[model samples]
Target: MTKVLPSLLASDFTRLGHDIEKMEAAGADIFHLDIMDGQFVPNISYGMPVVEAISRTASIPLDVHLMTLDPEQFIDALAALGIDMVSFHIEATNHPHRLMQRIQQSGMKAGIALNPHTPVAHIQHLLAEIDFILIMTVNPGFGGQKFIDTCVDKVRTLDALRAEKGYGYEIEVDGGINQETAEICREAGADLFVSGSHLFKSEDWQEAVREMKQ
Candidate 1:
């Protein structure tokens, strides 16, 4: 089954621990933490303290998407918190290969995130070295943006490339992923679906999660 990795950035922080517990029970495969810096993106999300708190409570794996410049600085800190996976935007780094090696050296699976305009061919050479690929269906920064349908074909191309090269990197689709959009990406061979607003902002989170996972 296609996995659902819910973005906790949209969750009610006042009761985030409770929400995480609920989602884990609802069959969420992983927790996606969008680590944003005001420089890399327009927004600045919580820092290590908040992440540390979440790590203390979340039973499942934590996949941190670095939306910050110089993401290399956080590898050791994130590794210290036992982050399971870390993805840095290709646009943010000058040396993704080194970053990938460092992330893996720190004991976290390394991934690369591509913005909507970035082509699948951009990361062609790095595919074999990555553990996963995060294709941003919306511009990376804040949550609740509209999904860019154009990115679906990029997912398809990446899927085809993976098959042709026999690569094992999982394809992760983030931004505006709900049941319908998730299904669209899933059809294109996306492995991990990261849903935020559509899941956390739902009136019925269980039903929403069930919808995305299905």
Candidate 2:
């Protein structure tokens, strides 16, 4: 089954606790947190404090996506907060292997994220060392962008590579993932779906999440 992870980036910050309660009740498998630094991505998003706040009330696992330069600088801190999974952009760190090891040693699942413009081959060497792979369907930084069509091919490529190598990493697709686009990704072998605006903006979030999972 494809796991649906609602991006807290697009959630109602005012009613965060209530929103999380509703999403959890709706069967959300994980909570996706987009952590951005203005230097790496054009926009800056919430940081540790916000994540800590979310962790206080979130019952599900926290899947933190770091869209910042030098992601290694924050791995220990995030892990200390009991984050379940930490994914950093492959382009963000100079020491991918070391960073992955640190995350694992810190007791958190490590993942690598690829931007829409990045090729799948870039991280193929480290696939065996990671737990999950996040493919950005839209450029990182902000939410509510249209899905980039070519990203689907990237997902297919990663899925094919995983099959060929027999790697255990899960394929996660983020950005512009709604019911229709999510079906496309799911068909292409993506197992995790990160829905932001489409989910939070829905009149019936429960039905929306259910449709995405279906």
Candidate 3:
């Protein structure tokens, strides 16, 4: 089954608690958090405080996507806060192998994210060291961006890598993932789907998840 993770990047932060509650009731498997620092990405998003709030209210695991430079600086802090997964951009750090080790040592699921321009070979050496790989289908700054069609090809390439290595890593596709794109990713071997705008705009959020599950 494909897992549905609702991104909080597009949620109304003023009423974020309520938004998270609604998503939980709607059967979201994980709460996807997009953390950005203006330098790495184009925009600055919530920091540890906001993530703490989500961690408190979220019944499901927090799938934190760190789109900042020096993700290693904050890994310990986030891990101490008890998030389930912490994903960092492969290009953001100098030592991804050591960083993955630290994350695992801290008892959190370690993940690596790939940008639109990054290739699957960048993570080939560390494939077995990760729990999952997040493929960005859109540019990483904000929400509601158009899906980059070429991402489907990237997803398939990563899927092939995982299969060849017999690694346990899951392929998670973020950005512009709606019902139609979800099918595309799944067919390309994606196991997790991250949706923000489509989820919030849905009339019946839980039913929306059910449809994605199909």
Candidate 4:
């Protein structure tokens, strides 16, 4: 089954706790947090205070995606927030392996993310060292972007590589995921789906999540 991850990026901030509660009731497998810095990404999102608030509200795992240039600077802080997993963009840092080691040393599962333009082969050698991977189906930083249809192939290739190498990393897809795209990625071997604008903007949050899980 494809695990549904509701992105807090698209949540109703005024009622974020309520939204988190609703998602929990809707069977969300994990909570996806998009931590964007103005440098790496075009936009800036909420920081530690907000993440801490979210951490206190949701009982499920919080998966934080660091779309920042200095992702290593945040590892300890986010780990302190009790995030279950932390995925830094592969293009953001000079030493991903060292950073992954630091993240694990801080007690959070380490993951690496590839932008839409990056190929799975870019991180092929390090696949066995990390806990998971986040494949950007659309450009990072913003929500509501159209799903990059070509990025689905990255998921497929990563899946095949994982099988052939017997790697134990989870494949998580972010951006433009809805019920339809969820099915598409699942068929391509995605283990987790991150939903933001589409899921949050729905009239029925629970129903939207339920349909995505299906």
Q: Best candidate, TM-score-wise?
A: 2
| Candidate 4 Cα misplacement greater than 4 A, ranges | none
Candidate 4 structure quality by residue, lDDT tens digits, 24-103:
98888899999988999999999999999999989999999999998988887898888999999888999989999999
What C-alpha lDDT do the candidate models reach, one value each? 0.93, 0.92, 0.92, 0.91
> lDDT tens digits, residues 1-214, model 2?
6899999999889999999999999889999999989999999989899999999999999999999999988987898889999999888888999999999999999999999999988997898879999999999988999999999999998888889989999999999999999999999999999999999999998899889988
How far residue 110's Cα lies from its native spot in candidate 3, in Å, is 0.8
Decoy 4 TM-score against native: 0.97
TM-score computed on alpha carbons, candidate 3 = 0.97
- Superposed Cα deviation of residue 132, candidate 1 (Å): 0.3
Better of 1 and 4 by lDDT: 1
Error of model 1, residue 175, in angstroms: 0.8
lDDT of 3: 0.92
TM-score of each: 0.97, 0.98, 0.97, 0.97
Output the better candidate (3/4) by lDDT.
3
How many Å off is the CA of 126 in candidate 2? Answer: 0.5
Per-candidate total of colliding backbone pairs: 0, 0, 0, 0
Model 2, residue 127: what's the lDDT? 88
